[model samples]
Target: MPDVMPLVTAVDQLADRLRSLPQSRLRQGAAAHGLDLARELSARAQRLEFPDREPRSVPDEGLFVVADQVAVTGRDLAEAMRTASAHEVAEAVKLVEEAARRCEGTG
Candidate 1:
């Protein structure tokens, strides 16, 4: 089974990136939303209930939600970067999307 820690770490890194964006209604909203999703995912990962056996996979629904949130947050970040002509930030957002896809095993 693949480790889920990488996915959680990626989500945390994306959230940090989002939080560093310039303050604006869109940025604030997206960052908050993404962070909340990341937090929930992290919590779920930490609280797996299987007692005697190692889990074989992450929940598909949880992966889907993470992917969706990452896409939305990336879009929001791209839009924020566009307003400031921050091409580097836009690229970084793309990377975040890629990481999210990888996490979902869809990359």
Candidate 2:
């Protein structure tokens, strides 16, 4: 059989990462954006097992809540991945310093 192990592992990790997002905070933002974050999460959580068949159906309310939390957590991880692509601490530090400078006088 084909080596599907790696793919399965990746999916599980993705699912886990998604589940970690903070739904409570994201929910309010999602609402403003006309998104149903919880629904998105539930849908993703249903895929945690990485089934070969079509994903199982998730309840709207439950999914939305889960999805919201997942999104928040996922976003941080995604940003870290992208930042890593920059390939240097100096570059990352520069970005952080710039961001900090933006709020320096305001707070």
Candidate 3:
């Protein structure tokens, strides 16, 4: 099994940052960015877990839940990719890290 701890840690840190952000910051753009990332991660997980099935979109439950959405979707992806190729896992990690970086200055 590929060690997916790095992905887990990255998402945890990103979620923490999102949670700590002020309401103004979240409202400005952070929440949207987080939700986008969550949806992407969720899509990837669904594709990996069930290639033949249609992926469901993660809903927008307001800014307050963005952090939880990111964390939950990310972990779901990590779990789905547990048996995936190392390269594939690395790509997912990179995707998440890049999302975190992009969220550094949300609007």
Top-lDDT candidate index: 3
Predicted candidate 3, C-alpha RMSD: 0.8
lDDT string for model 2 (50-76, tens) is: 435564443434424443443442343
Put down candidate 1 lDDT per residue, 21-85, tens digits, no spaces. 44452232444445444444333333343335543332333322444555444443333333333
As a whole number from 0 to 100, the lDDT of residue 57 in candidate 2 is 41
Candidate 3 local lDDT, residue 92: 85
Better of 1 and 2 by TM-score: 1
Off by over 4 Å in 2: 24-58, 61-107
| Predicted candidate 2, C-alpha RMSD | 12.4
What TM-score fits each model?
0.33, 0.28, 0.96
Hey, what RMSD does candidate 1 come out at?
Answer: 14.9
Ranking by TM-score: 3, 1, 2
Q: Quantify all predictions' global Cα lDDT against the true fold.
A: 0.42, 0.35, 0.92
Model 3 Cα displacement at 53 (Å)?
0.5
Error of 1 at 15 (Å): 2.6
